[model samples]
Target: MSTSSTGVLVLLGAPLGNPEDASPRVASELVRADVIAAEDTRRLQRLLRELGVSTSAAITSYFEGNESGRTEPLIEQLYDGKRVAVITDGGMPSVSDPGYRLVRAAIDAGFTVTAAPGASAVTTALALSGLPCDRFCFEGFAPRKDGERRRLFASLAEERRTMVFFESPRRVADVLRAMAAAFGGERSAALCRELTKTHEEIRRGGLGELAAGAESDPPRGEITLVVEGWGGPDPEDATPEALAAAVARLEAAGTDRKAAMKEVASRFGVPRREVYDSLIDRD
Candidate 1:
């Protein structure tokens, strides 16, 4: 068949691990694309081989380093009425990958942009996590520095939706510990490692337990963490004394009485005004 004359760019989702996860539409598009842009040309070739889809389209490398330089050329091809297909090393393109820039360029150039959506680690982990999926947020990866990581967690401290994050196995424990400290040790969470692979395993427990275990074992391979959202305060367990003590510590650390009361109230799941009144009465 002749190459498509419609200047459309397709973002194809590659298999995360299981080759069969490739959708039939992805396979057909692979066979029909006029040009293929891949994050890793070799990996894309291997995936195509596994799917038994042969393509005559010229393959070009478009990864993090050269994505900017390659976007215009790809856009030019798209402008010339060619079916340009973009695929990442694994999963869908532009998702923590290098396809977003090209997609944005194509859209700006008045070219049609679409995707043959398929397997995604974000949704896959959320589904198997057994956590509340009704509403959730994806935090791709935590910041590397400790201060930045802490600040990031602080910003999300009040996020109600179940939180999903991707982390390197090397730093999984560290991130978990930070989460435990920021979100509380008792927060329900699940740590998923090597998902969909032969060594797939999902460990569910309190953030404290998970953080300790992750540190002890040091998981390997891709890691996806699913953390339960704040379910209000643990009034049944947190005593008034405990809340007051927490407020004192915050106040000692230079936090204003009002802010300290708010933090303590949130930390202990009590009424902010009551905590404030208690502080005032004690003073």
Candidate 2:
């Protein structure tokens, strides 16, 4: 169905913390859209008020809860040749937010999709993180469950690229602790909270120090964490003997021998067989 574009699907970026960061293009799209899908209808109304623009667009909620249910209907609107605009609570519509499904459906149905980029927490936190940003990865949100969270951190322990993660205020400390456990207590990191807001704060330290500090002074507001990658030698760089010695340390710290070896293997991006061979040589 490569017919002429029936309608346009515009994804607008909302301000992260500062309303002034909202772009003119975003405002224009909001005012011009025939239909607007918002993560929160009330928040969208507030944004419209701040922008001082009245929109006649049909507004509907399209957050994670209703995203699946809303996609088809929104796609139908696009097929009807109606201009549809999407906005999230903050930042872009589909980055750790809803709207991806609708975007995909719109394109599948031959509608033209476009974006009006604006303020983003991912880049904003990375810039303020004081860590290497030239190469980095954004991990949408830290997993809330203990085992899953640790597994996630363990999987990325040896990642050479700096890592960014969005976390809840309540779980920030726990996440830092988990990272320390998986990536080593001395791994450097930065915690950014309430970015661009009046109460904005940036705390930088080793994972352990950050975890400890969070105990006495609980963090508040939206949280973004930036973690330095393993900048030292890669695991493969270690001599087999060195691998055995490292495994020994983990065991001494109460990690099971098998578990320790597995962790070492993951951190080094090496096969477990190599780590096992080192342990065999030690024996």
Candidate 3:
């Protein structure tokens, strides 16, 4: 697809670890590229070698730091109708990675943009998480700062869909600890590390349990976290035990017993008397 005015901008998904996992289409397209914009030139070289495909395409760096400056040149190639392929260190481009700019630029410039999809740590972790993957949201990476990360977790506390995030191994423990506080200790989650690599490990447990384990061992390598979403405390699931726990949680947050009972009653459509009985039973 190399020509003068109908240049196509292709987003290629690189293998997560095992190069043999790459699809045949990706290999063929790499050979067809007139310009290959890679997040890391060295990784690109290794991938090319492993795939055993030779390319005469002009290779250039396209990463977070140089995206703005590098995009126009790549767009120029596309404008010239040259087949341009964008590939990151791994996974599909334009994700939490740096290919979004080029994709947007190409679309804005009226160039056709497409993809040869492959492995993704997000979906991979979700599938392995054993959580409800029917509907989920990818949160990318949580903020590094404690306050910011906690705030982000709190905001997602009520989200009903499953959530995914990428995190650094160094901060996984802290993030899990914060998640337990914001999302509750019993919230189910999975910590997928070094995915698609030889040392790939997946740790599945409640947020509290994982946080405790991480503190002692501190996992290594790339980390992707899949967290169970908030299912919400609805009236239908309001068993006496559930109601009491909910009220106690509210009271612990400084709500008075009477008000907490009242709120729980209103929320669950249960009698204030039942809520009171549950609290009394706790005592």
Model 2 lDDT per residue over 73-161, tens place: 98888778788999999999889999889888888888889999999999999999899999999998977889778767766776789
Q: Give residue 282's lDDT in candidate 2 (0 to 100).
A: 85
- Tens digits of lDDT, candidate 3, 147-195: 6776677567757899999999888889999999978999999999988
Q: What lDDT does candidate 1 reach at residue 252? A: 46
Report model 1's TM-score to 2 decimal places: 0.85
Over all chains combined, what TM-score does candidate 3 have? 0.84
C-alpha-based local distance difference test score of model 1? 0.85
Reference-based lDDT, each prediction = 0.85, 0.87, 0.88
Deviation in Å, model 1, residue 249 alpha carbon: 13
lDDT of 1 by residue, 6-58 (tens): 58999998888888989999999999888999999999989989999899997
User: Whose TM-score is higher: candidate 1's or candidate 3's?
Assistant: 1
Off by over 4 Å in 2: 1-5, 234-274, 281-283
Give each model a TM-score: 0.85, 0.86, 0.84
State each model's C-alpha RMSD to the native. Answer: 3.8, 4.9, 5.0
